[model samples]
Target: MTIPVKNTMDKKQAITAAIVVPLIICAAASVYFFVGSLEEEHEDNQTIVIVTIVPQQEFVEKVGGDKVRITVMVPPGASPHTYEPTPGIMKEVTKAEMYAKVGSGVEFENNLMEKIISNNRNMNIVDCSEGITKMGNDPHIWNSPVNAKIMVENICNGLVKIDPDNADYYTQNKDNYLEELDTLDKYIHHKLDGFSNRVFMTYHPSFGYFAKEYNLTQLAVEYGGKEPTPQVIQDSIDESTRYNLRYVFVAPQFAAEPCKTIARAIGGETASMDPLARNYTSNMKQIADSLALEFEE
Candidate 1:
């Protein structure tokens, strides 16, 4: 329709309208797809199952691949030592088809396994620590590579029993992963071989299993299943200094400040290690490397 209009103004308005109309339509379509995708993702998240406990959860995901859904029971950054289960956590355990337990001093001190069984009577609770050998029932069985292999096998077996159809899949995964574990064991031994009569101190006594495997001595700062008192701290500092220790091992989930203070007091440094790391191979490698660097110097 040719109406009287300011020539340049009319042309500019027409161009603007032409550009804006398609842009609005395209934006609306894009929003529709984005919302649809979100909805699909939400549904997928709902369908996936959850696993409790960090170590077990990690092992399950490794062996299960995309076939299994897992959620860790302990929240990240929470101390498993003092973590207490809530009603909501128990509900999750109840819904879980299987439960993977470490059955160590940490969980026992916190009283975790009883809570899971008390809540979920029907759910199969598999002790990944089964068949684990301890020099004297040392709770840190998961620390050693050989013991970790046993744990992975235990997890794979649990998965098979839970989902029988996937037995072969889990078995195949177990066989492949076991070789990597054996490699880790060899690497650890090789690194540790340089240090005979090597000794270190830790905040918690969680490294006994690791130390035992490598013939190293780990003297814990907190001895009586309690946090160190002033006297205990002083005594530990003295002991570490006496040995001319190079590194003081600290766990990620625990407060390293006290240990750092002790290390500084004794003119030594602190090394952070994860007692509850999910990746078995990576965790072992890190520990071995840290120890080698610290002890060799």
Candidate 2:
């Protein structure tokens, strides 16, 4: 006699199978989460170390690649000139193996800063301007390509000191970064060379050094000491009209009222330029390209 073959999933058995399937999915998800966490822990433990004293942290990141962890002492949109380090910031710096000292000129007093750094005997402070030719009281050295290369060199040296095992990698990255900066500088020069007159007006004197380096002229409405008096403002207006100025460049944080006033009086338009960005290569290139366009027309 042939045995009867039954297709036999009852309602109770089908319900159990559905429930078990969901439980298995949940179990797998839990396992995956735990494995991912372990991998993240390994990566964290393997990361190289770094700290930046200023917002020029971008430079450190570029040079350090995946090896360094950098911190910016000052936050974005805050003026570094008046940024006083808190107790917490000081504590962090004391613990760091290196500090990026982009603070020079009017931003802070060197003597006081020296005392602070001296107290952190374990920390080596690398002035980003090391081997750089400075232009003015504007501590925004990272704004220029030539100065940016110097900053990259300082960063590489700091990295080697912190993680000597990665010295070759850091050096290679530093050289590559410098080469790119050189190319940017040359490209900017080529673009600006076509302009007949490089004179312009600005609300702040932040670009004094930048202008000096590129053979551009800037007459400022604001100086480090004080704002121009009413008579001076009138004179500035007259000068702008006399020179037939076409561009009035203002900084990101400055009030547009003053620039607008000057622009209206001179029959010119306005442009915004920033000198404090850490990504100097791109920022400088933008400024150079924009200025070239403004002047050429």
Report the number of the highest-TM-score candidate.
1
TM-score of 2: 0.78
For each candidate in turn, the TM-score is 0.79, 0.78
* Model 1 spans > 4 angstroms off: 1-52, 108-110, 135-137
Q: Model 2 — which ten-residue stretch has the worst lDDT?
A: 1-10
lDDT of 1 by residue, 1-297 (tens): 346557877899999999999999999999999999997776554313344456556677667776766767776656666677667776776667777777555554347667667776776667777887656646667788788788888888878877888788889888888888889899998888978548888898888889888888888888545878889888889988788887788888777887988889988889988877777688889988888876775
Tell me how far the alpha carbon of residue 164 in candidate 1 is from the true structure, in angstroms, after superposition: 1.2
Candidate 2 runs further than 4 Å off: 1-55, 85-95, 106-121, 225-228
lDDT of each: 0.76, 0.71
Candidate 2 residues 166-191, lDDT tens each? 89988888887778888988988888
Poorest 10 consecutive residues by lDDT, candidate 1: 44-53
